[model samples]
Target: MNTTTQPTHNTLFITCFAALVATSFCFVLRAFVVDDWGHEFNLSATQKGELLGVGLWPFSISIVLLSLLIDRVGFRAVLWVAVACHLIGTTTTLLATGYWSLYVGTFVLALGNGAVEAAVNPLIATAYRHDKTKWLNMLHAGWPGGLVLGGLLALAQGGGVDWRWKIGLVIVPVIVYSILLLRQRFPVSERVAAGVSYREMLAEAGYVSALIVAALIVIEVGRVFDWSLLLQGLLIVAATAFYAWYTRSPGRALFIIMLIIMMPLATTELGTDSWITSLLEPEVVSMGLQPGWVLVYTSALMLVLRLFAGPLVHRFSPLGLLALCSAIAAVGLYGLSQATGVAVLLAATIYGIGKSFFWPTSIGFVAEQFPKGGAVTMNVLAGVGMLGVGIVGSVLLGTIQDRAIGHSLAAHDAQHATQLHATYFTSEKTGVFGRYLALDEAKVNASDAQTRAVVDAVVAGSKKTALKSVAVLPLIMLAAYLLLLLYFRRQGGYRAVALTQSPPAA
Candidate 1:
């Protein structure tokens, strides 16, 4: 377990980084092609959000489940599962016939993504135990690297190439990473090497964290299958009760607070990324620019910044950096809500820099603060973030767009709005928030050019409003990070906890 002496350390790190790059390939490709799927499947905005969310939320299931078992099962085995999932999910998506097929494909892909993180996060954390935060940030550079590369590749394909072909590109990195990693020797996790018992690791997360994750799973799954309220509640209770009985702890207070903070943080970063291409489509297209370029541009910035995070973490400390980034992100999101023409790129630059460190730094914080929790603490934090963005953030943003468009259309032209509602907005969808009517894509397409123009204008406004609505998320995160900064300051100063040392008292 002496990481410095491990011969495969650098190669394994590269392989892990490549695996994450493969995951981001799936993400960026899906983000770019979501509109194509919407058109082909005649999907509403909400349905499109569901497609995007499926590409994310299912990540939680595989990551959380696999994290708990990875120590016993080994990293290579879990990565092999990820490889299989990638191939199968890509194949399914390529052959998709409609919304349901696309949903299944994305859901399976998310599972593969989760598996990759479950293996790589702890693998890298253990590999660079002495410099966990710095190395983790360096490792996560692959995410934005893939985003930049994948986004550019998709953009290069232009309007002529089929979306299926773009999706198939995910297999390239998959093949490369699999070849590099499958034959490599895996390392013992730091927790196991330190003789941290299974019970002790479980205590690091405990029942409170378990309850939050369990509840989100139940709620999201219940929504999908139309499960009764009673069933969902019972499932949540049973799951939490079992965990509490076994762990006999409420979880550390700071870990729980971090878990809560993850929701808004994930929504601000991943959720915004999920919708950015579509949200800015009208503005970008009007300026004769491709919407995907904004994503590519932002990702390139992130890629470069993350590669240099070691210095930044040193200067600001982890919590201080998070607090600073949260405020920057809030400003950036608000700027994006109002930016137009060439200014959009400027806004995106700020937003990209702000979000660049959020994911990796958060992981670093959890890994440093709760090393005894091992993969469970790190991956659970990631899983909950994905769950939050998938079930709530993505879908809620779509709902906001739909509602705003509906309201805008009504206020603009009441008679026309009523006519359009009767014709196009015929689908009634219910989500966690409540029931709302969504515009049917097929019906919208069948409308006259003038009607389409009017609808487009309304949609453009609504998209901006959606961005504005989401701007609040980062503000919430800023407040939370500030409070955490205060809490750490009162305790003397923020410091990365070591495995041999005890974590701060709850």
Candidate 2:
């Protein structure tokens, strides 16, 4: 489907389009399977999160390396090779059991993912230059759409399924994609612009290039680390004024802060990851569905939203939409924590809808705004930014999970130590979002009166303690992202963010 000689109106467009879907299909299952990974592999939350972050490390490195590669080689070569890497990585996850093996697998996987992202994203931007944001959103939507499918599998086959099988789901697509890509030819970045040589396109002002690269690097690294999401959020409320003296541009800092502001809110609000089974156990029983169906239904809803992502982005500004959706995510998470029986079903649906926009939209926004010469630099930045989110989310959620479990263990009677271990293990099995780990399900088995009494008591005690502890994070993140968002906007001024100002556009 992907062809070289002619413009992207046909071949190139279709290849990149399929590539995006394939890439999304491969990557969307991480959050769903993360906790189960720990359970299957016998790793801790810290271990799982770190391993996940390491999987993300390739994203950071790829940004720098791939950027340079895009200028030298071309998009088609990089895209297919990336697909090949994804196929290999996809298969590798099936066989990994030990921590090191898993880490290595993830490392390889991230590289493939980063490659796909690096190559196809910019290609999309260039292919639909007139409406970059719209196309990018449609492109990004593929990720969540994939996630939705994976989520269904996770439900139909809970995390308990052999990790290898879940991974193989991605491989089928990659093999098919490789066949398609091999059959088709496409233009390299150099060929995108008529008469532009690769060498000439690579040349740009030292000062401008430095700033541009630095900004790209910062965003890539920052998004991966997600430090500002917490730090900046806190800066917004702190009267002590640490933020005022911390940097030159507070607005850009705040933008990053906003990106993650709802994280804490969402964590407690949804209560799905760690407490998913517990939250829906009674309902699952009532509906005559397996416990895992909760995850499936949620994932299904998520996919439905994503498949329609282009239209959504066209109507709602990604940032503005996320802000509203985050508010909704917050409420959905909160509703889940508070709901019972039928209430939970409604809340889960809402939560899925809210979460649907946050990730893909963010990716699209970054791609549309900042262009670094060719597919390489720009794609690297996008990859790094998402990696930054991975890193930040892992660290933040891991700490909370640990602290909560430690408290729950210490709170239990000595006999519950075994129970505590089981709980801890359950949470660990869930990965980063495993904060509540197994604790959320602890009181679910009692009779209605007893369950209500225990839920009420736990809500009165640990939930209060847990919410208080987590609240500190987003407050800090708000200020940081707000500043960062504003700074980037100011940097662009009146010019549209998508225009890559290289000497010769690649």
Candidate 3:
């Protein structure tokens, strides 16, 4: 056993919030630099998707492992590991020369990210056990705040700035958080404080939820790497056996269901946020607005709104509020797909508001419904959300854009398509939509005026198509929220569970 004086609740809260800001900075950093990597590496759309997802899926590995071990290892120790990962990961990324190196860098960075969430989510929940939703929202306000700051920094650097230097910006937040967290002592998780056993906490997650998340991560990795059928089968069987052995309780069906729902919710939020700047670039350029500003604008709205989520949660109830957001976000995405000129602002506003509460509110819900589940439940849920965007959402959206562009061009300019086909398309590898064209920089640079125009039209159309396609995700979320709202209504109303709070001095 280890003993250390816990830091004040306010101090821990601020440190965790800074950690999240650093994490969020890492999340959006790629979106700004991906095109540069594409040009330098001759990356295909699918490859770019893989790059985006790389920052996410590895998070699950670290979070899952650490969530199980955090109680034994101590939070401060795990956090120091996180700090090292961030420093080394950023250095690795800056020094990267090729695809594999970049992949390694991103994967390591995600390890730090996962570690942060695993340590901090439970820290904040325990620190403010009585008002988990409100404080959690306040803590998560760091995400959008970081995005807005990063967006502006990207803008000030201008589009022509070096990718390495742009990525180096994250070092600032990493240092800020490090200074804040390095010496602070962490409080025990609420469950541990309340004398809840590890087995009881593990049982709250159960075999069903664990199995579902495990399968999704396995399938995503397998799909990306083209794992052999036997390998996939073995992994599935292993996961099944482990979860079956560990989980004894019947489990909370609603909590398990929410884990699955988090996939689409993540897709609707982070996935969309990842692509929004690229998706709106053509319109933003035409309207004399910087593409980065669109992200900044949306993220600004998210920052402000999330800070005030407490009142909204109080008025609408979490499920009811989420249902309302779903409707607005679905409509907003569809409108964004169709919008031109100033109308883009209107659509983005709605979308930002919709996503603002998703990640934090979901965490709050798990804390309320299954306080006994402890850090494992919270980390698993956060891990799944990240994987949802990185593995499924980002990858699928990239493929959608690839196919949409290829198809539109094939229909209108078969000769040019044939030329591009010979230059870029491979018959052996089909993406989610169809055969993908490797985005060859040389060929693109050499295209004639008319060919370039045709390519631009195809790209513009494809981006729009991608936006319209993703709009469906929020519609699906709206339905899920409605079901949850009705369920809560039947149960009387939304009420947060009170766990063991920190002592008076804390």
**Top of the candidates by lDDT:** 1
Tens digit of lDDT per residue, candidate 2, span 150-259?
Answer: 55665566535765666677775576657767766544342235344433333321122323334434543444355475553443334223323332222232223332
Could you tell me how far off, in angstroms, the CA of residue 325 lies in candidate 3 after the best superposition?
Answer: 1.2
What local distance difference test score does each model get? 0.90, 0.52, 0.81
Task: For candidate 2, give the lDDT of residue 89.
Answer: 75
lDDT of 1 at 407: 81
Return the TM-score for each candidate structure. 0.97, 0.66, 0.93
Tens-digit per-residue lDDT, 291-327, candidate 3: 8788899899989998888898788877777788888
Report backbone clashes per prediction. 0, 59, 0
Candidate 1 Cα misplacement greater than 4 A, ranges? 1-7, 415-418, 501-506
Better of 2 and 3 by TM-score: 3
Error of 1 at 289 (Å): 1.5
TM-score, candidate 2, is 0.66
- Per-model root-mean-square deviation over C-alphas: 2.8, 9.0, 3.1
Residue 84 lDDT, candidate 2, scale 0-100: 67
lDDT of candidate 1 over 41-129, digit per residue (tens): 88878888888898899999999999989999999999999999999999999999998899899999999999999999999999888
